[model samples]
Target: MKNQLEITLQNRKNLHAILEQTPNEDLLKIPQGFRNNIWWNIAHVVVTQQILVYKLSGLQMRVPEALVDKFKKGTVPDGTATDAEMKMVADFLLSTITWTKEDYEAGLFKNFNEYTTSAKVTLRNVQDAADFNLFHEGIHLGSIFAIRKML
Candidate 1:
């Protein structure tokens, strides 16, 4: 099996492609407020990865605090994002994934915190964390796709 970082990188790439296929206007429409829009979901994934990799693993995360609230979990866009801002966040997410892979290979992750879920145990190391994150990303991706179909 590929390492956790590789799997996560692949998932990120796949998600980027999926997002690109979504029309820009469709990215902002949330169906019934049950789920966030495509853009919000994408941003959430980026924020989540940064939080887990940087805060949880003690790696560097350059994302600004001001921007963190904008993309942090449960923060939906109130139609406040300019086109430029949306694009910038998307670009930054892609870059962050690349940087994370480099750091992973360099052994920057030292923590091996076990992650438990009600369903099952998820991770036992950085590699495991990466795998779990990739799985989580898929869940987000599914939500995005389902929301797109609804909208």
Candidate 2:
């Protein structure tokens, strides 16, 4: 069994490969409801990594403030992202994952608060949070894949 951090890192790598194969124009189409495109999903994962890991661990989010509202959680895609902006976000996300992996492996977030929502599982530590975040990534990845198939 792989550790939580390893699993999370693997998932991030997989997502990056998926995005690399996905074209820029495919990132703006909405296949379903108010859900954003692949670009939004990718950005959300990166942003949430900063929020849930760095912030919870008493570290600052390295991402710029100007990009926060555009990629923050609950900010749906309105077909507003340009090719350059999408590339920027993608590069930032990849770099953030590289930085976050070391922190996670160091066990710096061992004492953070545990959150138990109405969801199917309970996260009690950084391990749980890492695992759950990977699951969250899967949800968004699936959504993106479905949307891409539709388009």
Candidate 3:
């Protein structure tokens, strides 16, 4: 599991580089045929991790309610993210994972509300949610790469 987290963290750093160097205009632009922009995808990665790990674990989430509403599954780009918003997203991209690792190691995740994900996998424990989160992030990372190409 630690290996998985390390691999995912490394992938996020690479994704962060791509996003950091991308022009703001390109990050916000939804090229033709794309359903969302790079900013939304990045934010979604952060938001989804919170929901899967924190919310499902019956713990208070680190991200705000509005952010979760905006980026939860089944939602699309609401609008272009400003520079400040993008920076915030960039921060959470790494911070949240670090916090989760700390929280897991500290045994903060003692309960899970028991939710089955859209992929039909039931997460009965916090570790399951954490494992599932890696798969979820990988999908969104691919989306980010595809969206970046369109910009």
Give me the runs in candidate 2 sitting further than 4 Å from their true place. Answer: 32-34, 105-107, 117-122
Cα lDDT of model 2 by residue, 25-61, tens digit: 7767777663677778887887776766666556767
Candidates, ranked, TM-score: 3, 1, 2
**lDDT (tens digit, per residue) of candidate 3 on 17-74:** 8789988888778888888888888888888889988888888989889889988898
Residue 130 local lDDT, model 2: 67
The lDDT of each candidate is 0.72, 0.70, 0.82
Winner by lDDT: 3
lDDT of 1 by residue, 122-149 (tens): 6667665666677778888889878877
The window of 10 residues in a row where model 2 has the poorest summed lDDT is: 1-10
Candidate order by lDDT, highest to lowest?
A: 3, 1, 2
Tell me how far the alpha carbon of residue 136 in candidate 2 is from the true structure, in angstroms, after superposition: 0.7
The true-versus-predicted C-alpha distance at residue 134 of model 2, in Å, is: 1.2
